[model samples]
Target chain A: MGHLSAPNDIEDLLRTLSPQVLGALVRRFDDFDICEDAVQEALLAAATQWPREGVPANPRGWLTVVASRRRTEMWRSESARRRREEAAFASAPADIELGAVLDDSLELLLLCCHPSLTPVSQVALTLRAVGGLTTAEIARALLVPEATVAQRISRAKQRIKASGARFRLPPEAERSECLAAVLHVLYLVFNEGSTASSGATLHRVDLIAEAIRLMRQLHDRLPEDGEVSGLLALMLLTDARRPARVSDDGALVPLAEQDRGLWDAQTIAEGAALITHTLATAPVGPYQLQAALAAVHDEAPRAEDTDWQQILGLYELVRTIAPGPMVTLNRIVAVAMVRGPDAGLRELATAERDPALTGNHRVDAVRAHLLEMSGDLPAARDHYRLAAQRTLSIPEQRYLAARATRLAPDDHA
Target chain B: MKYLILIYSNPQSREIWNSFSRDQRAAGLRDYAALHESMVASGELIVSEALADPSLAKRVTSHEGQALVTDGPYAEVKEYLAGFFLLECPSMERAIEQAARIPEAAFGLVEVRAIMALDGWDI
Candidate 1:
């Protein structure tokens, strides 16, 4: 094994090998905390040894071999007799195949994001296990206290172990439901990057890139899973416009005002191709249908060229499969664009009564826009204020506030 | 190989639970009984039982120099431990498979833990 020379190269190698080593240790120990600690120790050893020895030819394999030995040493140091017995058992075979173990890491990823755990825990654990991100990095990404993120990760690992959650993709019968949970976490990560639930910037490119990487991994593993392709398409299409999502001054830019030329044509093309391929496979699911709609919007050269009628039809299909208030609210906007603002406002009024949309900021923000367009300036102003108060993201709040300002009477101030 | 499965359920929703018809209760009981039989057949189940009502439960915790006793349930939460099962399996994967088979997991919660085989412990 040759030692790593360049510091930058070593850092990259460590980041890449972290997940593999963690996956192997987790498999052997069947305890995330112990596995994580062992992997960290192995990393520290690498940091000291690699600079002197140069980088290993297969860094992942080297890390696994070292970490496995360290775990055995720790177990033995804790108990002699048990260690002796376990050593004898361990000597029967050294079955630590790095490639197979890394493949199984996807199973671990899904297990971390299992619906059984809370959403916060799901995201935290996924970042830890899959992204190989430190707890502090996760804390920064989530905009929470580092200690809180640390505690959540610890509790989540403990619960997973105590629940005896298997680190494997669920059976085919349950794959759809299980994959939905994984996709939900990835989608939430993308949404956070795009709008930033609460952050100084409107978008975080790193988060979006990580999500795209994971989606690509899923697409590679499950080529036949249309929803996986659909999700990748959706992410690509949304991310294609990221270069135009904000102004040079870092203020939010709505899609209508965004520079169309700034959008990544390559991403848009790939997304459109994926959506078309998924649609060609008859009996497309909700996600694929939604991605198809996004593909259409991405193909449109301008806001006026948007096929709202087709978009509305896609939303109806999505509602049939996965009914939710967010989808309904989005459909209402499409209806407003095509039919009339009054019709859209009426739909929004009914949607506001939905338990799911009761406190949703986007619902109120859309209502404010429809009201403004319909000439009800006072009601629009009130709704905009309500939206601004409910929203957590500074950029989103600023946008709502600007809308409110436009509606406010000059004499009122 | 030894696993402990803890079942959690809402103990305070008498109105919702009591509304179940006799057939519903019987169906629920049958589901649980079938799970127990399956585990026993696989030679995984060691011991299992439903607990008494939460009102009869007692909790003992050591505080400072003295042991404190608690009345009724400990956490004052609607969801409380409803039952438990001890199983011996070939691997953690098998243990999780058995945990997922538990009827309580469908609508409630079932947590599984591997028994620590430290010195002085026996399974």
Candidate 2:
């Protein structure tokens, strides 16, 4: 990966490799920001020295050594009394196993996404340290002001420091619980890529790819975990339809209007195999069940051929396990498709009354669609406007506006 | 290499400070001590200290060729500048490393800036 060394280029390289390098350094230093800073200094040194030295044989290992040495030197120069004290405590020679440290970076990813932190903070830091995203990139993906993302990252780092969180993988006993957090983070990442809550384009393929890569890493490490397999299936099945989700103008193409031939057959096949394998082993988890439902949809050659009953059943299971407002909203759509629009409208009416579902644009959008299907053009138009007003994503807003436009003529006085 | 790490806090208002119990304060102090020890061991930290509450402090600023004095901080904010650390590091990277180690940064802010070099200024 040798190239012309410029300041911007150095920054780009640091952003790309910071997660792996900083994670390894944290294990060595047991301090997140210190490790990060040392790595930054090492990179700066590299930027100044590497061009002259023509890059090291193993750049990562070389950077780690340089950063670790810098830390020791800085410590020694700071205080004589503390240096003597540390010298007394540091009786044993330090081990510098770069390979093992690099391998432990995966564990750091899990820790970064731990449930202790808020989801926003978890996503921000995970993107920075695990996905190797710049703070600006994370800010853009999150649709937050760049300064906000920077503050969140700083606060998250400070909290991790104050809590004395270690740099090792969760113990065997806590692996299941810890793995759930990791999965949740990856799922959020993939979802952001799949639909993209807010962006000029409806999808961020890079984020989706990065998430798939991380999920594959998880599956490799924990082969017996059915949920891991389930998650992989869910992502693949959902991603299989990416090609058919948009038109050439980048406008969203509803599933019913999409050409089935455009779907990625390879992804769909892999997803179906994973889902089937997962189902055979144990009672399928929510992700696995969702993947199964998507598989049913994918199996159908046309929209009319979809097994709505099976999808509704899976939704029922998903709602029972992970009963969220979004799941309920999805369940309503399935009900409307299987039974009638009236039945879906009834389900949505109940969800709309729930305080937790209030202000949720997806619920409003689903309600509008059901109302439109049921021939209540006026009510559907109202809900469509509501959905458009509530949604922050440009793509979603455009979809709602388009739906409203399509229903406008019938609603006109 | 010379850096200024300012810690922001409000001393007059007990509301924010009182939110934490005695044990929490002790824990904070312990962490601060540990960080101080680490900074001292690292040999980059020059001098660090906490202020005696902003209520008891005064600000002197020059305005329009005249000296202006204020009874309280320059601005009325929820948090005030509570302490600082003057450090000499080899680079901005080291300065940030030390900044992150500050105890106040866990709950408050710690801004790190490099000191401007003067032609004939003596340390």
Top TM-score model: 1
> Which residue pairs in model 2 clash with each other?
A74-B42, A75-B41, A75-B42, A77-B43, A78-B42, A78-B43, A78-B44, A79-B40, A79-B43, B9-B80
Instruction: Write down the lDDT that model 2 would get.
Output: 0.73
Question: What are the candidates' C-alpha RMSDs?
Answer: 14.2, 13.8
Q: Write the per-residue lDDT of candidate 2 for residues B94-121, one digit (tens) a residue.
A: 7888788775566657798766331110
Name the runs in model 2 displaced over 4 angstroms. A1-20, A43-55, A73-81, A84-94, A143-146, A195-205, A358-364, A376-379, A410-413, B1-123
What value does the lDDT take at residue A31 in candidate 2? 65
Weakest ten-residue segment in model 2 chain B by summed lDDT: B114-123
Candidate 1 interface RMSD (Å): 23.4
TM-score of chain B of each: 0.76, 0.73
TM-scores of the candidates in the order shown: 0.70, 0.67
For residues A230-323, write the lDDT of model 1, one tens digit per residue. Answer: 8899999988987887677766677767888999999999999988988898468877877887788888899789899998988888888888
